[model samples]
Target: MILVLEKASAWWDYAWLTFKNPSSSFVEITGYYIDRYASVGAFLRIAPNSSGTLGVQTHLLQKGQQYSVYVTIKGTQALEGPFKVQLPAAESEGT
Candidate 1:
């Protein structure tokens, strides 16, 4: 995830998660949650050899939040994650 590239003047902090499927088959990411809340604009489908991304609003941090990513592939029992949700240390602490 990308969180280090933030500026103090920014109103919202950002983080990113990206993935590529190496197989020859198309896949759908049917679920995505961050800190137990569903992420906005999370992907529903990802073409083969293509990538998918999950975004985080790090500006919304609360006492150094705990978060994770989860994915369920379509038409299969394949499960891809519970990946750690990491953000760069804040540029500056704010109230």
Candidate 2:
């Protein structure tokens, strides 16, 4: 199974993580920040030979701060990354 971090963004007090699974086997993903403080763990089952997007929510996402995200597959020794993502600065009001 292969895991890819598609996109990551922050709004208010929440962070949204988007992922893609492209493989012929069901995948279970566990993700967390490298700090090991604010973390989220869940099993994402993407059907075989199909592509699906998963949105995971977490708290305390600072704007413009680069985050190291760690992802691992359940029941397997497969580790994707400490993927680095920089949250874009929040949009200002009135464009």
Candidate 3:
């Protein structure tokens, strides 16, 4: 399951949760930024666990810009999908 976190800023400040398949031995979550220019940012490993809450710091992003985060999960047994979240510039903090 995937959930889009609200009140996110350019720094990536938001809390999100990811579920790992019980049959899977490992799970990895990656984070990226999508700028208004339709540019893809570098992929960073935000979470490297099976199941847990990701407390992201939005400071990773730049001000006056928008971004979207996506994650891909692979289980050892079965079940795989992509999760994504969109961030708007209006939601960013004036820091």
Clashes of each: 0, 0, 4
lDDT of 2 by residue, 1-95 (tens): 27776777555545556666667678777554444555567666766655544454433555656777676677767556766666556663123
What ranges in model 1 sit over 4 Å off? 1-14, 35-41, 56-66, 89-95
lDDT of each: 0.53, 0.60, 0.38
lDDT by residue for model 3 (37-95), tens: 23233322324333455444344455444344444333223222323334435455434
Q: How many backbone clashes are present in model 1?
A: 0
TM-score for candidate 2, residues paired by index: 0.64
- Superposition TM-score, candidate 1 onto the true structure: 0.54
* Candidate 1 CA-lDDT value: 0.53
Clashing pairs in 2: none
Deviation (Å) of 90 in candidate 2:
5.9
Q: Candidate 2: which stretches are off by over 4 Å?
A: 35-39, 54-58, 90-95
On lDDT, the leading prediction is 2
TM-scores vs. true structure, each candidate: 0.54, 0.64, 0.32
In model 1, residue pairs whose N, Cα or C atoms come closer than 3 Å (at least 3 residues apart or on different chains), thus clashing, are none
lDDT of 2: 0.60
